[model samples]
Target chain A: MESGNLRCGRRLITSETGRGEVVKIEGRISFLGEVNPKEGKLYDGRSIKGKVLIAEGAKGSTVGAYVIYALKYYGNQPLAIIFEEETDPIVVSGCVMAGITHGDMFGKLDLRDGDVVDVWEEDGKLCLGISKTPP
Target chain B: MHLTREEERMLKGEYGEAMRIAMEIVVKVGEVLGADKLVDISHAHASGVSYGTIGEPGLHWLRELSSKGAKARVYSTVNPIGMDLDDPNKIPVGEQFYKKQMEVLQAFKDMGFEISVTCTPYYLRKPKPFERLSWGESSAVAFANSVLGSFTNREGGPLAVASAITGKTYHAGLQVLENRRTTHLIVHPELDDPVEWSALGYLVGEKVGSGIPRYPKPPQDEESMKLMLAASAASGGIALSVLEKVTPRGTYDIGDEERVEIDEKEIEELFRFNDPELIFHGCPHSNLNELKKINEIIKDKVSREFWIATSPKVFDEALREGIIQSLENKGIKVVKGTCSVVTPIERLGYKRIMTTSAKTYFYLNRKGLEVALVRVRDLWRVVT
Candidate 1:
């Protein structure tokens, strides 16, 4: 197991903080079609409930913000959303309205799914602390 | 980020609670994107109005905003909803669905939006060259930037609303003149058919991702450009496409960069004729010329379950020109305020849908519906 401090680009939604296992999507996600908001499930049937979701970024419909909101409404929202690339307007607005923890991390971390990560704010800057854990 | 005294007043809740919240959203987005200041926009178009797309939570948020006295501070417009507003019965949705969709539209209307209910706002009011806008519809964002030589970053639904309320957006992305040029070049095939143009757009979008693609001799006609740009925005996150001799000079620049060539075979391979239950048009809302062409083709003899989805404003114009009645007489349903992409067509009992729009084909297929692509000229075969 690997553990280290991860730097965050900016804190988008500081209303909430989260610490949980990571569910990493290697590519960008189109929350509108790729996500089933009612179930908080991705296209491949993975549940994002309570996990710290890591993705490249978001794409597709501008309505994707609502899909992100639905995840919160259905009680299956991720603990936090960490984008390897910079976050787009859709995901930022979604996390803002949904009160979910969202931030951009620099580069790709040598992290995998089920890695325990803590996403929080320190002195108005977003911070991440990771402790690798297995499923 | 620097805010004007008036902008600071709004942020401090001097304008209103809604205006404060809106200003916060704009400022936050600007800070995230590293903008120097906010730019006053001429227009703002918000998407995510469709009930089927946004669902229950979206409706609640919108209603909440409307209740908080969030009104448009600029010339704001809204995208299509889940059902036809003029004739709710046109779409095959249950009573509850109908009511919810109406409430969604009402929320936006209450906020003083024009309810343009279209992805093609350019048709209603053509943006002048270099006009700054904050628009949500990806296709319209691409069209306005690439075709009309306007400036707008492809905004998300909420960001657009915030811009509308604040009458400003973060001055970054396409709004900045220096970022408008692209080194990526697409050697487009010579094609006259709008369907082929759409296909080219889809292919280019897939290859280009978010980068702008400049063409040497791109299609100049409005219809061709519309289909191509819409398809590109659908498949790829392209907001600006530079075309030589078409786009106004000085809005964008071209650099000697990577070149990708598209062949006739690639474009031709996308076309397929199929027995679709519904033959739909106006994915971006049919312009007067498109309506006139469809009217000339049908000529009072329609043989299939056809639907022409358009904005209410365009429908009124077509009605005045006698094209709407002629198409209606031939049993073609000219639905307004909704389209196949945003509407839940699967629940409406439509399985196989066919259209000439690559945007429609891409989005409908994403929704798990069988979509067939054909040319605009060949639409007659499907209609008959």
Candidate 2:
């Protein structure tokens, strides 16, 4: 019903889009990466080793279902996803599956890949103001 | 909002307390989506009971809101749950998890639900393609709306069940045949093989999130539908593409239609060149026939170490038939429950995975899934 003068970026960590509130933030070793709206890949094809990251929703989980647990255990994926929606099923499902702490009310970043994002909390609401981003 | 005489009675609580409660929840959903009136859908589908997210106060809140175990009189269906609780299978999960889940599912079954645990219920139990049926599988929702021409609103996990039980839904966007119309103009198949189908679906879905799409004709097969539907769910939330002549209703079943254009780049990312970690199949959960074909294609693969994924039900069936066990003896993992994109492969400390399945290809890359990549059907050649 209400939106501000926003420069919408194609990433999950910014508030200019559907799940703009930076609810939770994670660091390197993030798995079950949120399905990024920008990158379009469910995996986003990024090197999260030490990069400040962003993501959409969660992926998949369940202990013994047998699709990819062994692969992740050996792969060493350590990155975090930004909560764009209430509970992005992809990121949540992935975190649950990977046994990682997927955050929702934790970090701040007005992301657009290379954008110098201005994210903050206003009262109880989260807001993002982007100053720059990658083309 | 004019209510039918029966609807008015239910609103006044003249109907049994249970029906009244169910209607209340339906009404809320209707209001949220800005529906004018409620309509009757003959069939429905739901997410079913499983470990809900750590986010929501668990699914118990949803359970409490509606009659969880209430019998769904409508010809209803459901998605797969979190692994079997009481199974004595070879790779059975913990008994506690099993017992706990069985209790949850039993409540629903007690309420008059059937326990078929597949995603594309339309396949296992054929619904006349275009007939309006309520379903919750995101993949199935789009598939139903677009491909099958069956009517649905992409109803969420619990709401889908509520709609089934009460025999009525809030009648939002799914109620009328007008807003239910497709806007996407033409979808040209960019990928000739199944591998490209994943990215193609992702591309289309991302462009038309929560929007309607009309396409040339879906791949006239189940595997193709699965690949496209999975990416559709991944790219956005849900999309009900107007499946042209193939749609259940088509000209005979469709209303007036319009067209919207899509970006080619959107469809390409799914096959975006990335190191592979694993090959995935059965986005809507592979059914038996599909698995049988996949098993046949992989029987003599030289890859001592690789991962193949499907539902536990299929895996168990494959195991009982000695298909998977033989492959396991050959060091292949025909596993279930976990997807390559979400598995904590780094935790187990292995590196790299290779898989085919556009759904997996897109998802794994986002979470930084490690490894190599291969086309899904190529692995099928192994058993072939």
Candidate 3:
């Protein structure tokens, strides 16, 4: 397993760990404009349900927070969210409201799309363990 | 993070579940942002009220908070909703959508939030300099920080709601004096027109994302500054911009900030546009002056839809001054409680939209609507 240390995260809602396949969007995502919470689909038509979503950070409208909440309401939320840099208020607030496991990896994590990953907090730090073989 | 006795009590559920949850959200966000203490705020303005924007989940969350006996502890106002609360026929959304939208509105009302229904809350209640505020709308936050010299981080909807319930926010980011220092300097060419000022702001915001930019010669009037601040925030996520003469002195220090220059050619290119099916104004909600100017320009009825979005307060002022009647006589539609940015314009079947505000153009483009940037003075020519 390929492992990486988390730079920052705070456990807000649920302390349960998350494990799922990975899906990475390269740049900042606007949850409101680019995501369809009803269908669990991204603008590029990728299903984010039960996947570990990683991106640079969130951008665009503040309504993005509600869109993320809608994702959870529709039972289409990601297993967890890992960001390269610090997350915006919309993303952080949504994760807190939806009980989604999230962390800022400080760009150290090098896992790719379709990789199986387990995300959890251990010893006050969020830890990510990625499987070697692609799913 | 240090919490006072009262804050601690609220967090510990002594104040009730609503206040407890609100304090928890504030404390959690403060911890995430590395805030050491919570600051008392004079006012809080909540955004993300639009049903088109927030959808069912937002409605659910607000209803839950209201049902739990949540009320605003501080003086609070709300942003615009999805449909025009005054007239349902103005927007194409059906009665079912209207009913859901009203339920959301009722939730806010039940929570003791003032039905301001405006993105530009600064116009309704002018915030004093050095006053701490918790405001959610991007344009309002930018204006509050940059124009009014009030302290506020660009908070999200949830945080703003929490702040309203608690009357406090984490003392971090723009609230702290050190973080407000300008890191970049942008020298703008002579720009008298409001549209040019907006374009310049858009360009500068794109070039310097999230950085506090200082303008050597900022817009002199409130209307121009409003346009600039709104455009900058929409384009770059900029919460603050230090104006040379306008911003209060000693609030920000420019310690060897990187410098850049914006010229007339760049501003000219922002006005490029073809024929538009609709002309929109007031992305940040037009002030009384802008409405009066439009009243003078449109002498006769035009063919295309000329829409002006403004706050209910401003609309009342316009109505009192007979400006609304003059505009309506010329077939201009005044929309309150909503604008092109937050409303679902794609459902309206309007393909092309033209506006003087760069912020409006940027957001509409993101919503997959065709938008063109046009000058306010030249909009009449295109519509006619």
Candidate 4:
């Protein structure tokens, strides 16, 4: 994780996260609003071609999984998902159970939009800790 | 926070052979979330009944564990049972819809739960708020926790029942109220109608993400509280986030002036919808007046098959009044316990779904279904 690799109390195969220049996501840790952007017209107008979404579980939509699954199946899934609160256990459970690793968002990782994030996986673990890019 | 001897035995597999594995899974889930002791859950509502296209092994493991006589030693509620149809009237339009309903129900009955088909079990049999209840309806959970002020976590499928039987839930999120203190979302709004409030909620769910939104005040009454809770639940799949001012512990920070702020510009943009085949409601089950309002609103405009799901109790009331039949005569199907979301889209005979509720809209969008959205009261207006 460009930010920091925090997975299950640091007990997984090491070097399992991605290494890249930092991307700081400047967004509120909302226990409201929603996570799945595809469900609303709120999706980016131009292209979310490389932007990584940092959210817990999506709000209001059972299709959260469907949208994520579709995006992943088509290679448009978020860079990673960080959860401050337990949104839907299924979100992480499904991702993990399916081997689709979205790096963990844990322990007060404040993210804002346009924060360049780098992600990857190793030994059944994914990481995406964030840091502010160079001003 | 102490465990009973019976619970301890269940943990160690003394009850049923399956309890050993099931209880262990519960214990592990709790341990991961740092729950202290087991809490008795009177009834539970569950989800894993639908065979997932996501995890086959997890599905298989659940099926096998359930097959081994894994009854939840406590009363439980589950998702709507799918019925097997012989004909569109024999069951409904398609066999697949009915079959899925049947399979889901059969799985529950096989596991020892007396199946009741209604989304609002509270209406059928209201579990007193704060009574330990294990439920899974996203909107229902919020209603239970925030509206009714109950004690429950979103029993994560059947395993949640295992935790309930053993009386142990991972004390991570919803179970712990203090962890529910407001995160203070500064809502900057400009409207206060139901439709506006609904859209504001959608925006809040989007902007707030996963932290509980703390307002400066609470909704004025049950009606306003209802809207706020609906929006909060919709944005947070788990539902039941504390409304800063109205909730028992959350209101202190939110004085009399605390409330939800609406971004009319954002809401105007968000409320836009394309042509929709159907307008659906009752994902969390509508209260009496809401149902009546629906009945009155669609008295004229409900030209297609409309669905408004509720508990059997509500369904019965409608049946007695002939409201259900009246709607049926008008192309609306007022069913019990089943909502349009869970029914196969094909079964509903519509490729596009539309709604005012952010929660419903999100699901439709997620499924790649064409959805036209309007706010709640607006939906009533649109239907009429």
Candidate 5:
């Protein structure tokens, strides 16, 4: 469980890279009901705007794709998203439509909230380089 | 993953920008979901049309796609919007909402979609057995996969739109024959009531999550089956279920499956008798039989507010048969092209809603309305 470098199963999107503090959510998110797009906050008041948002994966409403699009519309969107499990159709459609940097299959990554990381693509695969700074 | 020469051309942007983007989305989703290749789909149905649910951002996205010349390559349909198009003011949204809703419809129409504005597209054109499809609207997806024996995953709204533009979807999930097998068995008590069927579906869906459940003996009537299927999709992510007699044989098979029995008590707990300010039926939109049944029950004028929602085509037939006038004479408002669950019914100032469909029960409750699941037989008593 080293934190230096980790690889994902696939790089869903590789056109852009994201470098920001991690915002770790413990469970799956149903973007429609759990997120407040206008403020870019979760129901618990954690702001994902410009942060590297990570979660188990998506669940609940498929309308979540539109909610994610709304996040971009309101200028309250995450810089990137990472899923610990295989991404669901809701997340795939949302990230595709919203042009968000996302990857899946990092079920064993040793990461935490407030940690800094650089998410980029190398060899057509997703790479997460964890920063040395302690949170 | 394997791709045909045509699919490779699509991914390589041989098509327009809209088609390219749509193909990319579908391909990426397929890769993640373990799809080996893309398959041609006969039809596609897109959801997320409701302005209330999707908001301005969704409208903007639709406009962008349409402006880029994205069109449906196959026969396509859409889900319900936020308002009743036949009577715009009935749902009680602002002028801004009406304008935005129209723009949403125009975008879909521009994409060559039928703009049917219904979750029950099976009524518009029933899918044949083993037809490949990419459809949104969870309830409709359930009906297509579980009841009609068609092949489709429960696709998200945007993904379905993408599939419509590309005329293809990744071969995965329920589309594969082996994936259609039942992993669990659902046992329930004998119940003739539609509400009881709804409650059973909710219970089973909540218990089974996304796993396919086989019902040994399901209700024979179409309305009751519709209620059950819709309820399951609403409560859980059940795309396909195996109904012993109802589901087309050979479409699904049972393996070593876990058995889950419905407690009669749980079904009873789902039923509530609280007086609601408005009573609504037809979450999936009422069929002709449902309309006639409602017409026969409420002989006297309604003592409280009552509304029946149906598709535009059904409404037209009901109008021709004088069912509309008969229900209207009894103070029942027959809403078309929209239902309470999709529209902004909560904003109309109703504190509680009484419905017979578990699908309606789940959605109306989510809308912050106090929803009560009442038996269909007792609907007349509640209305009075």
Candidate 6:
């Protein structure tokens, strides 16, 4: 299990934050091409529905922002998003518009796929708790 | 971040619900990008109009905004849709899909957006030097910054829409003068054709990614420059490139920039391709001259399908000048307001395609289509 202070540009869009299993993708994702918003399934056959989707950042089309919106519209959005590198405007704008909670990994924590993670905001600071056991 | 009195009023919802929503999005994105304040913008262009790309959720989102009485405060233009709005039956899309596409289009129109439907807005109205703009569509951002001497970040569709409504964007990224400085100087081997220029841009974009590159010599022709900028934006997310003498003076500083040179052998690798089932042009929407050049190339009818995509304005001009008829007489299909990159070519049963635009090749390859890069001059010979 691993834990770290949450890092992001601004405050979380949603107030309610909870725990979920982490689904880590190694590369940058183009939501338009690499994701199916209707099903919330990635091109690799893994599901992002109700999980903390971790990735390097977004790539490809600017239409990617709307894909994230579609994910929420279909009730298949991720529990949260955790990215490493600079968050492109497409992802950031999409998360804001959809009212999804997202933060940055900040290269401080080593996370693995299937790791159970909990996130919350405290004293104007975002905190994360990681555990091996399923929440 | 500091906000003006009027900006605060808008954020506080003194300005309608649409303005409040737009202000929230702008300020949120501004904070994320570390923008200190908002800057006024003269124009905004919104992308993500294609039904094939955005699907039902995007359609609903636009309709929702229209219902909320969202209207553009500044002059705004829209990107290409999934099919031609004027003549939808000409495209092979289903009637239901066309209706959905029209719904999205109508919503944008209701929001006071001009139906330009072009990736290259510079073709319609060129921006002056150092003019602030809020533009989506990656290729247009690159072109506007590098070619038209405008200041704009590579905006997302939602951000551009927000800017259209609010008439402002965050003062960050390429909108800041210090951020637009050339960091790398790339010396390239001489290129004669538009395809070669596009290939060079594609290679450089992949090498530099988001970094600005300074080219010793830029393509002189409008088509080649357009292709170069489009390819770079497609391949590497490059928002701007500084051309030696072409880019306006005092706009970018290239002092002591790290220099690199690209040889001819490297560019030769990009031109290798197999025979193509279809030929496509206008990833960034063809200019009138490109349409004329294509019309001259296909003098006689050929066997394979040749498609030329252009904006509605260009298409109308071409139609009036008999360029469309000449191409159509040669069995070429000229489409308006959409291109192969944004549309789903699978519906047309086209698995393999060849194009001169590296931007088109890069995008279609990601969409699981077989794309071959070929020179525009060599297209007729190879395809036939």
Best by TM-score: 5
For model 3 the local lDDT of residue B291 reads 97
Candidate 1: give the clashing pairs: none
Identify the candidate with maximal lDDT: 5
Global lDDT of each model?
Answer: 0.85, 0.52, 0.84, 0.53, 0.87, 0.84
Measured with C-alpha atoms, the lDDT of residue A104 in candidate 4 is 40
First chain TM-score for all predictions: 0.89, 0.35, 0.85, 0.51, 0.91, 0.85
Instruction: State the lDDT of candidate 2 residue by residue for B200-230, as single tens digits.
Output: 6766776766666667766666677667777
Angstrom error at residue B328, model 6: 1.3
Could you tell me how far off, in angstroms, the CA of residue B314 lies in candidate 3 after the best superposition?
1.2
lDDT of 4 by residue, A8-120 (tens): 32111122134333223344332112333333212333233234445443343332333343444444444345444343444433343222444443545555556554555
Q: In model 1, where do residues sit more than 4 Å from their true spots? A: A1-9, A18-30, A33-36, A39-51, A54-60, A106-119, A130-135
List each candidate's DockQ score: 0.59, 0.03, 0.53, 0.07, 0.78, 0.64
Residues B152-252 of candidate 6 have per-residue lDDT tens digits of: 99888889998999999999898889888887788898899999999899988888888899988899987898899889888898999998678898777
Ranking by DockQ: 5, 6, 1, 3, 4, 2
TM-scores, each model vs. reference:
0.91, 0.63, 0.92, 0.67, 0.96, 0.91
Candidate 2: RMSD to truth: 11.5
Best by DockQ: 5
Cα lDDT tens digits, model 3, B1-384, are 999998999999998888887887788788778899999998999988888767789999888878888999888999998878799999768888898889888999999999999999988789988999999999999998888888999988989998999999999999999988888899878888788888888988898888999998888998888899899898897999999888887667776698878888888876767578788999899889999998887778878898899999999999999999888888899998789887788888888888989999888887777887777777678767
Give the per-residue lDDT digits (tens) of candidate 5, residues A1-135. Answer: 356766665678764586788898887888978899999999999999988888888777778889888988998889888888888877887888888888888776677878888888878777787877732
TM-score of chain B of 1: 0.97
* iRMSD for each candidate structure, in the order shown: 1.5, 11.4, 1.7, 6.5, 0.9, 1.3
Cα miss at B32, model 1 (Å)?
A: 2.3
Model 5, runs deviating above 4 Å: A1-9, A132-135
Worst 10 residues of 3 chain B by lDDT: B268-277
Mark the regions of model 6 whose C-alpha exceeds 4 Å error after superposition: A1-12, A18-35, A41-48, A52-60, A84-86, A105-107, A110-118, A129-135, B382-384
What TM value does chain A in model 2 reach? 0.35
Q: Residues B140-230, candidate 5: write the lDDT tens digits.
A: 9989888899888889889999999999999998889998889889988899898799899999889998889899898888888889989
